[model samples]
Structures are given as structure tokens and as C-alpha cells.
Target: MELFTLSLPAAIYIFVMAYIPMFGVVVAFKNYKYDKGILGSEWVGFKNFEFLFKSETAFRITRNTVLYNIGYMALTTICALAVAILLNEIAKKWLKIYQTAMILPFFLSWVVMSYITLAFLDHQSGFMNGWLSAFGFEKIKWYFEPEYWPFILNAVHLWKAIGFSALVYYAGILGIDGELYEAARIDGAKRFQLVKHITLPQLTPLIVILLILSIGNMFRGDFGLHFFIPNNSGMIYPTTDIIDTYIYRALSEVGDISMASAVGLYQSFVGFVLVIAANFTVRKINEENSLF
Candidate 1:
């Protein structure tokens, strides 16, 4: 009774914020008419989903979305784990300072980050251009070029996101028993050996869990990073276009609520399946570590 009472607020919050909106998934299968309303709309079966798959932007956006997310998952996991290990080795005096500096960027709004990105990449008065021109090199328009965006976006994503991911791994490290480390040291294990055996093994479950969550969202791009960092330059859309950004543009420009809902539903369904599959695989390997 006590536990049920404690969870009542969270249940209400989820019902209000999360589960309630799930009804909108029906719009994905309907030829939604605003005047007719959601329930009154005519069912269209898979027609809306067909439009998404057949559209020219479909392949490009889907490709970019999946590829970018895969790259991010790979890079961020490796980098964050490295950073977390490094942080774990820090002494008490400097650990607090290091942690504060690392987490500061995670708290900044993407809008603020957009401006910061613009300041450095702005064509005429930007820091990069200024430095290049000072060295007698011709100034390049950063936003106009699509070639540089992959690296630029990845770097910015790492900068903005690594702090939080690193902290998660840091917490995972904290949960590890100190006795393992002490035993390693008593056995004359070197620092690198201890990390290779003790730290990495202990962190595998957390790493796998995070990886599964990341894979579940593979089709969903970080809209703020893609939209804001590139400043929505049409020329760079070839490379930077992702499902979320594409859907946002469709929503803002065409006001196609049905299409937007369809895309979102597609993403959700795929994510749901992937998460289930991932959890199942985890269960097969180690039942206790499975999310369910």
C-alpha cells in the first residue's frame, strides 16, 4: 500500500504526459481532417507510411539519420568510457573541478550552443576564418560547404554530449566494488592491467544497456544539433538532413500534421521493436542484466 501510494503521482504523470499522447498514433493510419477531428478521420491503412517510404527525401533522410546516430553511438561510447576511466583515476582535490568543468556543457541549452557554434563558423567575422585569413589562406564559408559538416557535426555532438555520457559511466564505475581494485593491486596488477580486467568488465553491463538504448533511437536524430549547428542551410541538407529535421520542416512549411504523425509513429514502432529485441538478447546472455 505504501509503495503503491508512493508511485501514484508517477503513474498519473506518465498517463498524462506519455501514455495519453499514444492515441495520436492512430493519426498515422488516418487521412486526418482537422474539421472532422482525430476520431472522425477516415482510416487510410498504410497509405501514410507508404508516402514516407516513397518520398525522395525518405531515403536520404533515413540514411543520414541512421548513419549519424550509429557514428555518434560508437564515438561517444568510446570517448565517454575513456574520459570516465581518466576521471576515476583523478585525485580528490582535482576530481571535483574536473567533474564540474565536464558537466557544464551538458546543462547549456542547444539555442545557446547554436549561437556559440555560429560565432566560430560565421563566414566573414568567424574565429576560424579570422585565423585562416591571418595565415594568408583564403576564408572558406563553413555553412555553405557540406563536406565539412560531417566532421563539424560529430565534433560538436561529442563536445555537447560527452560530458553527460561520461558522467553516466562515472556513476557505473562508482557502483563497482572497491575490493576488486584492491585485490588487483595486491596481486601486483599494473594500472593498465587493472583497468583492462576490472574496470572494463564491471562496466560491460552498463555499456551494453546504454548501447541498447542508443540503438533504439537510431532512426531519431538530435534535431537541435542538426538544425541549429548548420543554421538550417539548404545547401547542406544533402548531408545534414535527418528524419526529425525533415519532419520539422514538413510540419512548419506544409502543416501536414498527418504526415508528421506518420513519421513519428514509424520511428516509435521501430524503436519499440529494437528495444524489445535488444532486451531479449541481453536476457539470453545474462537474465539479470536485461532491462525487463
Candidate 2:
């Protein structure tokens, strides 16, 4: 009875905040007239979804979303794992200090990060152009250049996110049995041998779980990073635009609640399918590492 009482508040919160909002998912299928309300509106079947896919920009946004997310997952996972291994090798006192400094960027919101990025990337009075002029080079407009955005976005995201991710990997590594390391050392294993033969194998399960969860969000790019960091520069839309930004622009221009809901529903549904597919493949390869 006491445990149930302790859990009641959280149960109520989830029901009120999460489960209740799920009913609004039906709005995706409806015409969603303001006067008619959600259930009273006309059901338009899959027409709303058709509109999203038929647009000329559909391929571009979808390609960008999938490609960018794949890049983030691959690059961040590699970097985080490397950092975690290095952190594990460090003394505890320095580890704590480095961990705190590394995670400070993760604590910052994307809006704050946008301003920080702008300080460095801004054309006339910015750090990059200032350095270029000092070196006898022409000032380059970073914001207006689509070609530079892919690398810029990836770098910013890695700076903010890799620390937290590395900490998670480090925690998983710390959970590994110390006696196993002792045994490996007594067996004449070198540093690289210890990492390759022990640390990585033990960390595999956690790595697989994180990778699976990240794959589930492959269709949804970070909206704030793409939108705010780019300052909504239209010239950079070719590289910087993604599904979340595309949906935001569509709703802003047309106020189509049904269409917005449909696109959102599509993202959720495809992400669900991809997660299932990825887990299934992983399970087929190795049941122990698979996220069930």
C-alpha cells in the first residue's frame, strides 16, 4: 500500500501528460477544422500524408534527415567510446574535473549554443572572418554558405552531445569486473590487448543498446540545432533543412494542423519500424547484445 501510494503521483502524471495526449494522434486523419474540433472534424483518411510526400522538397529533407542522423550516430559513438576509454585510463581526481568540464556544453540549451556558434561564424565581426583578414584572406560569409553547414552542424552537435554519451559509456566500462582486468594483466596482456580483448567486449551490450535507440530517431534531426544555429538563413536551406524544420515551416506558412500532425505521425511510425528492423537484425546476429 505504501509503495502504491509513493507511485500514484508518477502514475497520474504519466496518464495526464503522456497517455492522454495520444488520443490527439487521431487528428492526423481528420481535416481538423477549428470549429469542428478533433472528433467532430471530417476524416480525410491518408490524404494528409500524401500531401507531405508529394512536395518537391520531400526528397531533399528526407535525404538530409536520414544522412545526417546516420553521420551523427556513427561519428558520436566512435568519439564517445574513444573518450570513455581514455577517461577510464586517467586518475580519478582528474577524471572528475574533465567530466565536469566536458558535460558543461551538454547542460547548455541549443538557443544558448546558437549565440555561441554565431560569435565564431558571423561574417563581418565574427572570429572566423577576423582571423581570415589577419591572415590576408577574404572574409567568407559562413551563414549564407550551404556547403559549410553540414560540417558546422555536426561539429556543434558533437561538442554538446559527445560528453554525456561518453559518460554513459564510461559508466558501462566502470561496471566491468576489475578481477577480469587483473587476470588479463597477469596473463601478460598489453594496454591495447586489454582494451580490444576485454573492455570493448564487455561494453558491447551498452553500445548496442545506445546504437539501437539512436537509430529509432533517424528520421528526426535536432530541430534547434538545424533551425537556430543556421539563424533561418534561406540560402543554407539546401544543406541545413531537415524534417522537423520542414514541418515547422509548413505549419507556420499554412497553419495546417492536420498536415502537421500527419507528418509528425509519419516520423513516429517510420522510426518505430526502423527500430524494430534494427533490433531484429541485431538479435539475428547476436542474441546477447540485442535490445529486446
Candidate 3:
């Protein structure tokens, strides 16, 4: 009774804030009219979904979204783990400073990152162009070029995300028993040998769990990065466009609520299935680390 009373407020809060909004998912199937509103909107069965998949841009946007997320997840995971291991090796006195510097970028808003990125890549007055011109090379229009965006976006994602991801892994490393390392050292293991045999093995379960969670969101894109960093220049949309940005453009520019809802529903449904499937695969390989 005491526990129930203690948890009552949280239960009510979840019902009001989380579960209640699920009813809006009906909009995904309806021809949502503002005049009719959500409850009164005409039911269109699967027509909205049909339109969502039929558009040529749908394929392109879906491909870009999934591919970018996969690349981001792989790169970020590898880099973060590497950074975390390096930080763990450093002397304890300098650890806090390095961790703070690494994590500062994660707290900055994407809008702030946009301006920082512009400072470096702005074609006419930016630092990169100025340096190139000083070297007697012609200035390149950074934003206008689609080919450069893949590398640029990957670098930006890594720069902004590595700190947080590394911190998670670092915490996992710290939770490990110090006795294991001491034992390994007494067993004549060198530093690299200790990392390879002791540290990496201990961290594998946490790594697998994080990787599975990341795979679940493989279809989702970080809209702020794509939308703000490139400044939504249409020429670069070929490479930068993703489902979230596409849905935003549809709602704001085309005012197509039904189509936008359909796309969103598609993304959610696919992500749901991907998570379940990924979890199933992980459980098959290692039951202990599976999220379920």
C-alpha cells in the first residue's frame, strides 16, 4: 500500500502524458482535415499509406535516412569506445578535464552548431575558403556541393555525439571490478594484453546492448543536423534529405497532414519491428544482454 501510494503520481503522469497521446496515431490513417479535427476526420483506410509509399522521393528519403543512421551508429560506437578506452588509460588527475572538454559539444544546441559549422565552411568569408585562397587554390562553395556533405555530416555527427557515448562506455568501464585488472597485471599481461583480454571482454555486453538499441532507430534521422547545418539549401537536399525533414517540409510547405502522418507512422512501425528483430537476434547470440 505504501509503494502504491508512492507510485500513484508517476502512474497518473504517464497515463496523461504518454499513453493518452497514442490516440493521435489514428490520424495516420485518416484524411486529417483541420475543419473536421482528429476525431471527426474522414477515414481513408490505407490511402494515406499508399500515397506515402508511391512518391519517388519516399524511396530516396528512406534510403538516405537509414543509410546515414547506420553509418552514424557504426562510426560513433567505434570512435566512442576507442575514446573511452584512451581516457580510461590516462592519469586520474587529467581525466576530468578531458571528459569535460569532450562532453561540452553534446550540450550545445544544434542551432549553435549550425553557426559554428558556418564559421568554418561558409564559402566566401569562411576560414576554410580563406585558407584555400591563401594557398593559391580556388575557393569552393561548400554548402552548394552535394558530394562533400556526406563526409561533412559524418564528421559533425561524430564531433557532437562522441562525448556522450564515450561517457556511457566510460561509466560501464568504471563499474568493472578493479580486482580483475590487478589479477591480469599479476598474470603477466601487458597493458594492451589487459585491454584486449580483460577490458574488451568485460565491455562487450554493454557494447552489444547499446548497438542493439541503436539498430532499433536505424530508420530515424537527426532532423536538426540535416535541417540546420546545411541551412535547408535545396541543392544539397539530394544527399541531406531524410524522413523527418521530409515530413516537416510536407507539413509546413504542402500542408498535407495525412501524408505527413502516414510517413511518420511508417517510420515508427518500421523502427518498432527493427528493434524487436534486433533484440531477438541479440538474445539468440547472448541471452544475458538482450533488452527483454
Candidate 4:
């Protein structure tokens, strides 16, 4: 009874915020009308989804979304692991300062960071241009160039997200049994060897779980990062455009609620499949590590 009482608030929140909105997924199949309301709207089966798949830029946006996320997930995982290990190795005297510095970026809003990025990348009167002028190099329009954006976008994402991820891994490292490390040290294991054998093995389960969950979001790009950071330049669409941003654009411009819902539904479905596949692979490799 006490446990149920303690969980009631979270149960209510999940029911209200998550379960209730699930009904709106039907909007993906409906030719919705404001006057008719959600239930009263006519059903169009898969027409909205079909419209999404048939669009000319659909392939491009999908490719960008998947590739960018895969790359981001891989890079951030490696970097976060490295950061966590380094944090764990640091003397207690300096741990807090390093942690605070690392986590500051995670708290910053994308809107604020967009302006911060503009300070350096702006073509005219920007920091990059000012430096280039002193060296006799032409000022490049950073936002107008699509090719440079892949690296830029990945760097931006890692800067904003690595902090929280590393923090999680750092906590996981803390939870590990200290006796194991003591025993390893008694055996004359070096620092690198201890990390390679002890730390990495202990972290594998957490790594697998986080990696599977990340795979689930492979289709859902961060809208604010893609939209605000690039300033939504048309020329950079080939590199920066993603399903989330594309849906935002369609809904904002055409007010096509059904199409937007369709794309969202597609994102959710693909995410679900990826999660299942990743979990199954992990299960095959080590049943103990699988999310199931």
C-alpha cells in the first residue's frame, strides 16, 4: 500500500502525458478537420503515410537523419566513455571542477547556443572572418556550405550532449565494487590494464543498454539542433534537413496535421524496430546484457 501510494503521482503523470496523447496517433490516418474534431474526421487509411514516402526529398531527409544519428551515437559513446574513465581517475580534489565545466554545455538551450555559434561562424564581421582577414584568406560563408555542415553538426551535438552521458557513465563507475580494483592492484595490474580489464568489463551492461536505447531514436533527429544551429538556410538543407525538422516545416507552412502525424508515426515505428533488433543482437551476444 505504501509503495503504491508513493508511485501514484508518477502513474498519473504517465497516464496524462504519455498514454492520453497516444490516441492522437490515429490522426496519422485521418483527414482531420478542425470543425469535425479528431474522432469525427474521415479516415484516409495510409494516404498520409504514402504522401510522406512519395515526396521527392524524403530519401535525402531520411538518409541524413539515420546517418547523422548513427555517427553521433558512435562518437558520443566513445567520447563519453573516455571522459568518464578520466573523471574516475582524477584526484578527488579536482573532480567537482571538471564535472561542473563538462556539464555546463548540457544545460544550455539550443537557442542560446545558436547565437553563440553565429558569433564565430558569421561570414561578415564574425570571428572567423576577422581572423582570416588578418591572414589574407577569403571569408567563407559557414552556413551556406553544406559539405562543412556534417562535421560542424556532429561537433555541436557532442558538445551539448556528451556531458550528461559522461555523467551517467561516471556514476556507473562509482557504483562498481572497490574491492575488485583493490584485488587487481594487488596483482600488480597497471592503470591501463586495470581499466581495460576491470572498468571496461564492468561498464559493458550499461553501455549495451544505453546503446540500444539510442538506436531506438535513430530516426528522431534533434529538431532544435538542426533547425536553430544552421539558421535554416535552404542551401544547407542537404546536410542539415531531417525528419523532425521537415515535419516542423510542413506543419508550420501547410498546416498539414495529418502528414505531420504520419511522419511522427513513422519515426516511432522505425525506432521501435531498431530497438528490438539491437536488443536481439545483444541477447545473442550475451543474454545478461540484453535489455529484455
TM-score of each: 0.95, 0.96, 0.95, 0.97
Model 2 segments more than 4 A misplaced: 1-11
lDDT value, candidate 2, whole model: 0.94
lDDT of 3 at 65: 93
Candidate order (TM-score): 4, 2, 1, 3
The local lDDT score (0 to 100) that residue 100 gets in candidate 4 is 93
Q: Per-residue lDDT for 198-286 in model 2, tens only? A: 99999999999999999999998899989999999999999999999999998999999999999999999999999999999999999
The C-alpha lDDT values of all candidates are 0.91, 0.94, 0.90, 0.94
Q: Which ten residues in a row have the lowest lDDT in candidate 2?
A: 44-53
| Tens-digit lDDT track of model 4 for 74-146 | 9999999999999998899999999999899999999998998899899997898899999999989998899
Clashing pairs in 1: none
What are the clashing pairs of model 4? Answer: none
- Candidate 3 regions with alpha-carbon error over 4 angstroms: 1-11
TM-score attained by model 3: 0.95
Candidate 1 residue 118 Cα shift, in angstroms, is 0.9
Candidate 4 vs. true structure, TM-score: 0.97
Judge candidate 2 at residue 189 and give its lDDT. 98
Per-residue lDDT of 116 in model 1: 94
